[model samples]
Target: MVKVILFDLDGTLLPMDTDAFINTYLSKLAPSVAEIVDPDRFVKALLTGTEAMIRSKDREKTNEQVFEEAFLPLIELKKEAIWPALDHFYDNVFPTFSYLSKPSPLSRKIVEEAGNQGYRLAVATNPLFPRTAIHHRLQWADVADIPFDLVTVYEESTYTKPHAEYYMEICSRLDVRPEDCIMVGNDIQEDMVASEIGMKTFLVEGYVIDRGEPHYRIDDRGTLEALFRKLQRKEGIFAEK
Candidate 1:
């Protein structure tokens, strides 16, 4: 039984160029934190922190902790100062990032259709952003109204996807086996890697990126919708007895 359907936010549901999304994100993040420290240096330290987290042995640490360790000494400021920047990001700067990600009409239709079919939903987006940021992005995609059983946020997630443990945690929390889940996303490396854990994988081809490696093919979104329609009629995607 395909009990859970997990979808990535960026590039899958919300359409955007990956680079443009980050540039708009940083442009807005910089001005907001200018009052607290050197903006350029601050962003640099933040990047360093991000890299550190990628290599971190202690996956239990939140991105905030990873960030603060690299950023704190440079600013010589209290932890309280970082809050303003984050607050600004969640309330103001983050909204502006929405301009970079446009809503797709098919996004809502598929999500709504899937929900009606009784599949548990999850936004299995990479948990690099806080919950607020992730939530707002969902709203931007107009799929915010669609209830998700679990929205993985960096603060709460111990592991990022592409790591088998990440999918394991989601299955454990949702009480579903990896075999009962389908991870849908645009990135071949990040999203399709879920297959390694035995979850079904769907690559949304709307925004394809060829990274000079073996391509994990995704049946197009239209094909997916049709497949769901067939499922609704009890004609499952795979042959059934």
Candidate 2:
């Protein structure tokens, strides 16, 4: 049975320019801590913190911990200062970045329909951000009722997508096999990699990058809506095969 459907955020669910979000986020974050650490060093520390979390091997620790562990030593700031900056970043800067996102009414409708149909939906967004940040962004898309039974955040996941273990972890947690789930996302390399592990895949072409013109691309949410409805009507996703 196809018990779960995992969706990526940012480009996939939220529909935003990733670079714009980062540039806006850093601009807000930099000035707040400029006095505490060298301006250039602060930026370097922040990037390092992000990278460390990406490269983390300790699955038990949350991403925030990994970021702090990597970042704290470089800045020489009190441990307490980090949270405040994070708060400022999300509070003041994050909302503005939503402007970069192009809203899709059909996207919300599809996700809601999937939840109503009893699919185990999850916002399988990369776990680099804290849950709070992710939660707020989802709200911006007007996607309520966190449809996912399990949400994968960078902190909670030891491996990021493109790594088969990343997809396997969610499948294991949801008690489903790789072939029983579909991963939908805008990035070809990051999201389509799920196919390498035997899961079904969909590419949302509104944001697709040619990058060699990968196969299995769908042009818009209307196509995705059609697919979601078909899956909903199926008795068992793999039964036809």
Candidate 3:
């Protein structure tokens, strides 16, 4: 039986052109930090920090720590000197980028239905952003008020998506086997990697990031929503699987 349902935020739940969203996000973020550091250098540092977070394998340190360690040195600034600006940017400027994303009513319905069926819900978004930034995006998806069993954020997660360890970490936290979890996302490369550790996966198609060939067969969100309805009726894919 599936005990957990993990959903990806960006392209999956929050309808968005990922590249366009990032471009707008960084463009806004650059100006916010321009007073402390040059805009170009700050953007480079931010990307470097994100890369560090993505490559993080150290279970001892959080992704936030890894990002800070790599990011601060590049700009020759201390965390004490830069954190307030980042905090302000996320609190003030980040929400303005909500215009770049469209809320999916289906996403909310899926989450609500899953909750009603007693399935644990998790926002398994990539942990490159702080919790505040993630929370704001969740609000845009209309799932901010829906209680999530777990939400991956830089302060709590060490590994990023596309890494099997990332999925394993979530399973460990929830005290469930990977086989008992289902990951739903738009990126074939990142979300489908959950299958590497034995989690079932569903790929949402509209904003798909298709790579070579997926390791597991992919199912669309429509099929998944139908499956949810069937599960509610105690029939269909859930019963068969």
Candidate 4:
């Protein structure tokens, strides 16, 4: 029996103009730290920190720790100085970009559908951002109100996606076997990689992202409505083939 459904936040559930969001994020981020570091250098260092998190396979340090070590020294300030600025950015400026996200009712529909079917849910987004940042995006997706068994955030997550260990870590936290879970997302490479650990994969076609490297099997692919239909089947999509 499939007891859990892992959902990707950005393109899979939330319809986003990724470029627009990133541009806006960078545009705002530079200003947030302009007082402490050269705006251009800050952006460069921030990207480095983010890349460090993505490349990291270190289980001993949280993504947040990895990011801090990589980011702080570049600014020539203690974490205490630059930290509040990023926090302030997420609190004061980040939500304004919610307008960039096209409203998608399907995001909520899928979550509610899975919940009604008794499958546990997770907001399995890449744990690259702080919880508040993720929470804001979740709100923009219109599915923040529902309780999820896990909402992977950088402060706590040791691994980032596209890495099987990341999926395994989530499975470990939820105390569920990978085979008894479904990883649902739009990215062919990043999200579908959950299959490496025996999890079923579902590609959400509404906002498909196929990087074409490290290809993996997806058990199903369709719109969120089709997923709702799958949940309604007599034996459900979990039936062994």
Candidate 5:
């Protein structure tokens, strides 16, 4: 009954050396907020805020609210002082790092094929960044022009990936059951963990990150080209019996 297909960004939809992009992102981000905090403290505060989001069980508060509660304190500034820097970073700096991500040449085509087959689609990237940042990455993947039923942005999302609630929230919002979705991504832990909530898992190739741990169940594994062909068929992926 797979009514929706959840695609992870960073590695799944937007092919990228995640480590390089993240490191570069960290580097660029530090400079943006240098006036508010030292590079070391800013990174620490940022990671601490991210950790807060991951550890949070509160579904009522958005990740941004949770992040600010933990982050703005460390900088000794209010949201007004810090938001400008972040806004400039995402608007100006973030887009320039497309070099870090490998081109997702098949991204738009794959989504188009999936849509053609009557399946709902979403960009289920981890809800760490604001919508502005996520939207920019969507452009990098060449799928910004395509509409999705859901795009998990930190401003609205209460949880991040790997949490059962995170996947559950999506199903609840989309008005579908967990079993009615396929969570597709390249990460071993963050992406595949969607299977823990009864959603099917598809591990995209060439950007695997299993972390040497016991892996979760993956219903399928292959390149996006392979996925595209699957969509072109009448049976479709996760066809009804």
Candidate 6:
């Protein structure tokens, strides 16, 4: 009964060394906003804003709103003075980070297979970035063309991963029960937390991040090929549900 399949982008669909990607991303991002704000303060504000998004629990405000509320106050420049720089960075500079993420042909295949089988697809990446940045990363994975029912961007999401509300919100938007969705990701703590509200979970191997014991048993292994084959055989994680 898995009507929706939620895939995490960074480590799951797009293979990456998380730390290397972040370090390189920040190194590039810092200079892009340097003319408007000091590089040091820019990084600090960016990190602070990200933390605010992560810790956000306000159901009424989008993550972007929460991030701006927490971020703008700390810096001297107003949002109007700095937003264009940030937009320019995402449009022009962010694509350079594509080299940090590996392309996955299987990602597009699995998403296509899911869509063919009548399952709704979503990019359930943690919503810390703008849609443009997420879209660019999806392109790097070669799955950007696949029609995803939902892509969790900061402007749309109210919570970040590891919070059950995040999953709940997605389910609500999709009009599907938690038990009828499956979450596939490499991070045990962030992705598998979908199980807190009854979604089935899969743990991808290569970039797996296990923090302590996982909250729920992983329902299946996480290669797109394996998942696709299992679905073909009617033996997918929720096959019996």
Computed on alpha carbons, the lDDT of every model, listed in order, comes to 0.74, 0.72, 0.85, 0.88, 0.87, 0.88
lDDT of 5 by residue, 1-241 (tens): 6789999988888988888888899989998888877989889999999999999979899999999999989977888877888898999989899888887678888888878778899999999999998999999899998879999999999999778899999999999999889998999888888899899988898888878775788888888777766666634445554
lDDT of 1: 0.74
lDDT-superior candidate, 1 or 6:
6
What candidate 4 gets wrong by more than 4 Å, as runs, is: 234-241
Worst 10 residues of 2 by lDDT: 213-222
Q: What local lDDT does model 4 show for residue 171?
A: 95
* Candidate 4 to truth, TM: 0.95
What would the per-residue lDDT of candidate 1 be over residues 62-100, giving only the tens digit for each residue? 655766676677667777867776776788767866667
When 3 and 6 are scored with lDDT, the better candidate is 6
11-112: candidate 6 lDDT, tens digit per residue: 999989889999998999889877778899988988999999999899999999999998898887789999998899899999988888877788787778
Tell me the tens digit of each residue's lDDT in model 4 across 1-241. 7899999988878877677889989998898788888999999889999999999999999999999999888877899878888889899999999988876787787788789878899989999999999999998988889999999999999999899999999999999999889999989999999999999998888778877687999888888777766766623454534
TM-score of each: 0.87, 0.84, 0.93, 0.95, 0.95, 0.96
Order candidates by lDDT, high to low.
Answer: 4, 6, 5, 3, 1, 2
Model 3 lDDT at residue 35: 87
Error of 2 at 237 (Å): 7.4
Model 2 off-target regions past 4 Å?
209-241
- How do the residues 65-154 of candidate 2 rate in per-residue lDDT, one tens digit apiece? 888889899888778876786677677766666777877776687687778767779877877887767877888777856556887765
Candidate 3, which segments miss by more than 4 Å at Cα?
Answer: 213-216, 219-237
The superposed Cα distance between candidate 6 and the true structure at residue 231, in angstroms, equals 2.7
**Residue 192 CA displacement from its true place in model 6, Å:** 0.2
TM-score of 2: 0.84
